[model samples]
Target: MQGYDRLAAVMAADKGLSIFRSFKRLNAKNLLYLQAEIVNCESELDEIIEEDKNSGDFFREKYSTSVRCLKEGLGDETPKQWVKIRQLRELLDKYNTAALQYAQILRLKPPHAKDREVFQRWLKENAFCSTTAEFNQWFGENDENGGDLVALFGRYENVDALTRWVFRIAIPCFYKLVGYRKAKGDVETGMVYFDDDKIIRATRVTSTITSSAIPATSMIVLYLVNHMAWRLAIIVVYNIGFSMLLGLLAKARRVEVFAASTAFAAVQVAFITNFPRD
Candidate 1:
């Protein structure tokens, strides 16, 4: 009775599947018989394998021997050569993928078709993309030195370009006004951090004034406008203090001293006219 009931259930399932819909006639009983045959074959195979304890080990040894033979074919020198070739290929693939990904990610626009092509070629050659900080710094410097103020400002439509111009040009101009060195000194070494001592000193002075006046040119303006008598007084005091500071801290030549004074006076004029403190 149980066998009949099981047979009926299989028949019902086969009917639901529409096994008779096929070109060949296949029924529930035939399928059940095929399943039993599979089980029987599996059981027999397992019993045969169980009889041979070393069968698993034999397969493992066989696999290891095959792998060893294949490895040995490459030879000692070939392995290193192959490894380097593989690594280079992998790096090339990664670099190409990275370039493609970077182009999509950066979405940079070129001025002309030639420029666009050149940009794409450069992207393919260069694997790395500029970080946000690096990109900003690059743009800032480019805007400053690339063109005159009017040309740069008018040519560039983006606010970022204007901001970059201010940072690169305006800030440096104000830095010159301060009695700072063109070059900065290494904290550990008294040597200039950049190029020549003179240039470094000049840059330092300009940067210092720029730093003080940044985001608040009005204060510097007020200081300048308050009194004519006070201007010479402040200038004399600044000169004495800065000269003393330079004498104590620096090993600059007499020519450097003269250049710094000229730079300071020029900076003061520029500050007074272009970037009035008030």
Candidate 2:
């Protein structure tokens, strides 16, 4: 049996899906249909108002009470249609968040939408666990695992480019080399995490390449090119590559990338200033 499957079995007993204690997965199409149903019911309510003004009195009283709750809730307004719309909006927000995170996992723009982009996998992975229902949690929430890809893999943390390359290019190349004779379902390139310990290992190897190789090459190039302007040009080119690497592999956020790139540039500037090409 697969190690992941065994690990999953060992995790504490399953409590099943979260519904009574929490919300469930809801589709945008269904939500839209619900809005249509609301409109239909609203028309019925309107007809009731026209037919029996007396029943309308009860609705008015209820509306008045709801308005008071709205005041407490929003501090406050009668709202565009009804206060229930706000609850619907909140539910929509939750679903939008899950869609985006799933997209993040897919490395696709706007996330692999649970509805259509990757509906089958989404159905298998999501909305059942209380811990995973409201959010994608990226790797997911398990009793022992804590969703970091930490267990079964070590403490090293990264969702990185080298592993992604392995999944995207290397795995396919290997299959080709072996004439596609590998066991069926032996490897999967498309996964939420690609969920590998190899990611951590590859991250270290690539990190070493960046840390050591770039500087060594930069030093050699600076020495070979005597012209100061040409040296500055080389530094700029390398800096751009550095920034891109930080973004692609380091998972560095925009500001972190900017700061690190800036610091890297500053170091280059200081080096060129102090140790002129002789």
Q: Which stretches of candidate 2 lie above 4 Å from their native place? A: 1-33, 47-158, 178-195, 216-230, 253-259
lDDT digits (tens) for residues 1-278 of candidate 2: 23334223322111111111111133344456566665665666555434433444454435444655433433344433354555456656765676565444333212112212232244345344444543443333442212222122212235566555665567556666873664353222222222345545776688778767777787778777878999899999989988887777766678998998898888788878887864
Candidate 1 residue runs with Cα over 4 Å from true position? 1-225, 275-278
lDDT by residue for model 1 (1-278), tens: 23324323433432211111111122334444555655565565445435433455453234234645323433353332233334455555655565455444334222322222322333234323346443322123334311111111111123232233443455456556752456664332222222223444564565556535532443354364656556556655655655554443344566886677666655665555554434
Candidates' C-alpha lDDT: 0.40, 0.51
The most accurate candidate by TM-score is 2
Local error of candidate 2 at 205, Å?
Answer: 3.4
